[model samples]
Target chain A: MRVLGVDPGLTRLGLGVVDSGSPTRPQLVAVGVVRTPADESVDVRLGRIAEAFDQWIDEHRPDVVAIERVFARSDVSTIIGTAQASGLTMGLAARRGLPVAMHTPSEVKAAITGSGRADKRQMTHMVTRILRLDAPPKPADAADALGLAITHLWRGAVAGASTPGKEKDVLARRARTTAGTGLTPAQQQWARAMRAARA
Target chain B: MRVLGVDPGLTRLGLGVVDSGSPTRPQLVAVGVVRTPADESVDVRLGRIAEAFDQWIDEHRPDVVAIERVFARSDVSTIIGTAQASGLTMGLAARRGLPVAMHTPSEVKAAITGSGRADKRQMTHMVTRILRLDAPPKPADAADALGLAITHLWRGAVAGASTPGKEKDVLARRARTTAGTGLTPAQQQWARAMRAARA
Candidate 1:
């Protein structure tokens, strides 16, 4: 399947296309980036994002869309950026409610580089090596987009596996056995590992 | 050096202390959990965290504090949980004026396993293997606490001898770079690693 991977940003966005029949590795189809003027109003910038998404869809005709889910942010500006990035991604695949999968940054890094804590250079280098690109993807945007594509394939490799939560169920049972341990079984995190296994 | 590792949670807070020089992995001098009833007010829970922290410090007297830093939370409840957790951790550490170091969850995971995306089971399993424990630490809260401890030792072993900036820095850089392509060299995340090697 052809997967469209996106890395959203305020001033620039990265886009990439990859073919994922090969589980161990995938082929990079196209890698490019989009730049938006940050000084514009929110509405205008969003319009640009929408327009960019439309263009990408028209060009890639991806069978799947994979996005990097945004998480905790304190600053309003950053939160806005994160939402924009995440929203733009969702918007692109919104039509027909495509089966979009969002992976955490750690999940993506781990899938791509064998380490959740892999650095950008590591990720960039891995994306280069994995796709067998002649050179590193330009700007960091292209590399990240490519990483998203790689992450999608890794996720697809084992999508419905048991997760960390199953282990939580086990811990819950243990807590019940140890009653008055002041620990509730459901509250036990070990059992939760089953869900992580799924992730 | 003794490093105290903490895995913060709003409901159940975990703390661990390990000595850095004992072996390849630090010895777990002490570990325990503090509980806060959801029925209690936030301040009371925080007070509970404080009391637990005081008890641990008095008993363990760890030389350094290593905490898992909070990340972007999308849910209000989760964000609140994270904020409470952060406040409790910082408040407890600050009261003693202990040197505190924050590592993102991924960093801790990476430091423990080669992969940052390793779940709690993987983490717990690895922790048992790395610490050479006779039995796996029961209750993931405790297991996570142990994992954080090992991560500190691993990073400390390679501390300043290699790259800098925790995984978050790289993720954020990737976020910006992945979204947009106009990353300035100064804003580039890998520049630090590349420059350090050059020097």
Candidate 2:
């Protein structure tokens, strides 16, 4: 299954695509960041983001799209921008009849690093190891997007038979319950890598 | 000049159109509300809004779009939805090379009535008189949208030579400064009708 993960923002949006043959092995297909000028009007910025989504979706043709959900508690100024951007992405995906899923930051971190409070550095390291990339993706947002995509694949694949909306609830519930569970088999591999680096 | 005003909301979006021959005289062209099911997914709701915007803009061929600016302090659950809907409306207008303006709720109220603190009943009464309609527009949202369009035409025409973005700021500043001042010439006509009603 192929998935496109989006880290929605007004000024800097991160997009990552991954193809998963097995739940444990996901390969990176593409990764990039779309940046809009901070000085531009909100509508213009949103227009640019919409154009970028159109270009990416047309080129990548992912089976499903996964986006990081915006929480109201996060930076009030940015929350609205992020929500608008996500709305555009999801709308475009829905227009194409592709299923879209939303993952919280904590769920993405826990899915990737075995801890819900994993920091950016830890997420980058795990994403790198998961995709077997020689180097971590540039711009923390890009790596974070990859983590979102991987999380959806790992969790959604398990509940793939359910409807998209129901799958989201199931994944969210699982994320809450599995918060501190030592890592998935794929994350366990990364844990071994961390131990090896320490040695 | 032709203007389309949008009162952005997720479940019930309000839209109105008007043609301004003179700054003091504007004629209503169309008005309605677009309702989306509350149970629908965010993306689906956004798509419906986009479709509605397309239809309105295409039919009315508005020279510009005036949308209600969203404030973060509003109901937390609805704020993001309104923002997203407004973003879609603005994005669509921008795509068509049509200018878009945002008016605050207080600006709309003050423009329609002589006071920014005017209640909905006052707004509906003023809108009914201004539009020369047999009855007030159904669903307060629709009346509110017509008020938005009228506000833009009256205020924007005064600063019509300026750029769209700059005109919005200019109108907002003017609205702030002119609040509770004697009514505009068009508003004076409404005042007479109001006085006649009281008598």
Candidate 3:
């Protein structure tokens, strides 16, 4: 499956594309950031982002679009812009009949680095290693977008058999349970793999 | 100037169109609500809203779009959805080269009922009287949408010469000043009119 991951923001939107390779590795297709001038009106900025996103989808032709789930509590000032970008991203993908999967920040971290508490540096390091790239994707948003695509590629693949809406529902329930325990399914999977290797 | 007002919401979006009739009495061109099912995903809902808004603009051919400004502090549970919808509204309007204006909730209330704290009933009542409608617009959203159009028709008319971005900046500054003093420009205008009538 070809997946496009987006880290939605008003001023700078990070995009990463990946093609499913082996069970544990995904091939990097492209990674970049789209920036909208902060001086413009919010609507104009959103329109520009929409235009860029439309172009990206058309060029990449990804089967699925993965986005980072925005939480209102993250930053009151930037939350609205983030949410708007995320909404636009999802809308554009859905309009094209592409399935969209949203992953929490922690989920992406856990999926890429084996720990939900992994910081940006750790996430960048792991994403680079997993994709077998010589260097890490630059500007944290780009790396983060790659992480989102990787997360959906690994975490969402099993649940991907069902309808998109139902798949999200299942993932959401699992996310809630994982949040309650301060662990993600990815983290658990990593732990099991580590134990098996040790044994 | 013809204005299309939008009360942005994920579930039920209210839209109102008005034409510049007389300075004091604008004519209501149309009023209605567009609904997206709650069961649908957020992206699908946004897509439906975009489609409806596009059609509305094509049919009404409004020179400007007036939308309610979404504040993140209001109702955390719904704020994200509201912001997304508002963003999409602005984007759609901006894409079609139609100027977009946003009014605070208090500003709309003051413009319609001469009180920033006017209740829904008073807003509905005044909108009915101003538009000379036989009945209040069906849902509260519809009434609120009309109020937005009327506010822009009156409040925005004077400052309409400037570019839409600059006009919004000026209006935003004024909104901040008005909020601090607990009165909108509309409320002050209403007070002056009352004094003139008494004199």
Best by TM-score: 3
Which ten residues in a row are the worst by lDDT in model 2 chain A?
A: A190-199
User: iRMSD (Å) of candidate 2?
Assistant: 1.6
Tens digits of lDDT, candidate 1, A40-71:
54335545665677677888788777776655
Give the lDDT of residue B91 in candidate 2.
Answer: 69
- List, for all models, the DockQ compared with the true complex: 0.01, 0.45, 0.47
Best by lDDT: 3
Winner by DockQ between candidate 3 and candidate 1: 3
Two-chain complex of model 2, DockQ on C-alpha atoms against the true structure: 0.45
- Tens-place lDDT per residue, model 1, B1-199, is 7877888776877777777654354566776777779896444455556567767888888876787765454355455455445544543454455666778888877767667898988888877776667888655578778777767665554443233567545744675677574343333433333233223
- Candidate 3 runs further than 4 Å off: A160-199, B160-199
lDDT tens digits, residue span B65-177, model 3: 99999887889888888888888788768777888888999998977787899998888898887887888777666999998998887776545344466655666578668
Interface RMSD of 1: 17.2
For each candidate, what TM-score against the reference?
Answer: 0.41, 0.81, 0.82
Worst 10 residues of 3 chain B by lDDT: B190-199
